[model samples]
Target: MVDDTSLTSLPKCCLSVVIPCFNEVERIQQCIDRVLEQPVVGEV
Candidate 1:
């Protein structure tokens, strides 16, 4: 189980992963896949 103190120590900051595209229906899956595969190194 994750400790409450460790969770509370996390910084309050936004982690934005902007996927800018006009028509991203096809590429959206790939974008989401890549984003989800990435590990949260710092804030994200």
Candidate 2:
């Protein structure tokens, strides 16, 4: 098992959110807009 000290020293990574839209033409814009509002810390 890993130790607590090692976990704390580990580096942080970015997040990637994937959405599935079948026929969300109206709500698709809003969904993408909300996600862009957040800060992207990881690679794209």
Candidate 3:
């Protein structure tokens, strides 16, 4: 188990989100936008 404080202490934009979608032209942008909105999301 990991401590919550350890997770929160990390710098911003330290996380990268990966989304695998096939034939998702319409929803891909929306998904990417949401993922990028996160403070911890460095890249999508």
Candidate 4:
């Protein structure tokens, strides 16, 4: 198995979050807004 120490030293990279939704218009905005609030999230 891989060691956890090695993973911690890895360089940071851009993150992409994909939210596939159907008939979620009412709460989609809220979900996107919460994701955007995260410091590591560049886009939603």
Candidate 5:
């Protein structure tokens, strides 16, 4: 799981997968520079 370390380090996350459900499609997309829903994924 990503934590404060991720922000501090500015890590590079991946989104190379195949989702089946349509409801959570937006959760993932083209992993550009910044991660897509960083705020959506609440803090631990």
Candidate 6:
């Protein structure tokens, strides 16, 4: 079994979003802006 104390001792984690697009020039900026607004999203 896993220890709860060990989990609590771990450092905070950040998340990165990866978006793959081919021809999203018109909406890419909008997508990026929305992702940046997220509290846990560090990079897109």
lDDT of 1 by residue, 7-39 (tens): 989887656787786798889888777787767
Model 2 CA deviation exceeding 4 Å by range: 1-12, 41-44
lDDT of 6 by residue, 1-44 (tens): 87999999889897767777679999889988989898877655
Superposed by TM-score, candidate 1 places the C-alpha of residue 8 at a distance from the truth, in angstroms, of 14
Q: Candidate 2: worst 10 consecutive residues by lDDT?
A: 35-44
Q: How well is each residue in 1-44 modelled by candidate 3, as lDDT tens digits?
A: 98998998877555556688899998999998988787767554
TM-score of each prediction: 0.50, 0.58, 0.56, 0.60, 0.19, 0.60
Stretches > 4 Å off in candidate 5: 1-7, 19-44
Q: Model 4 compared with the native: what TM-score?
A: 0.60
List per-prediction Cα lDDT, in the order shown: 0.74, 0.78, 0.78, 0.86, 0.46, 0.82
- Residue range 1-44, candidate 4, lDDT tens digits: 87999999999888888887799989989989989999998654
Report lDDT (Cα) of residue 10, candidate 6. Answer: 88
> What lDDT score goes with residue 40 in model 5?
40
Clashing pairs in 4: none
Residue 20 shift from truth in candidate 2, angstroms: 0.9
List all candidate RMSDs to the true structure: 6.8, 4.5, 4.6, 4.2, 10.6, 3.7
Question: In model 3, what lDDT does residue 28 have?
Answer: 95
For candidate 1, the per-residue lDDT at 39 reads 71
Model 5, 1-44: lDDT tens per residue?
Answer: 87886787865554443335457556435432134345443221
The digit string of per-residue lDDT tens for model 2 on 1-44 reads 99999998988765879878799998989988878777763332
Flag the better candidate by lDDT, 5 or 6. 6
User: Judged by lDDT against the true structure, how good is candidate 1?
Assistant: 0.74
Quote the lDDT for 12 in model 1. Answer: 71
- Predicted structure with the largest lDDT when compared to the true one: 4
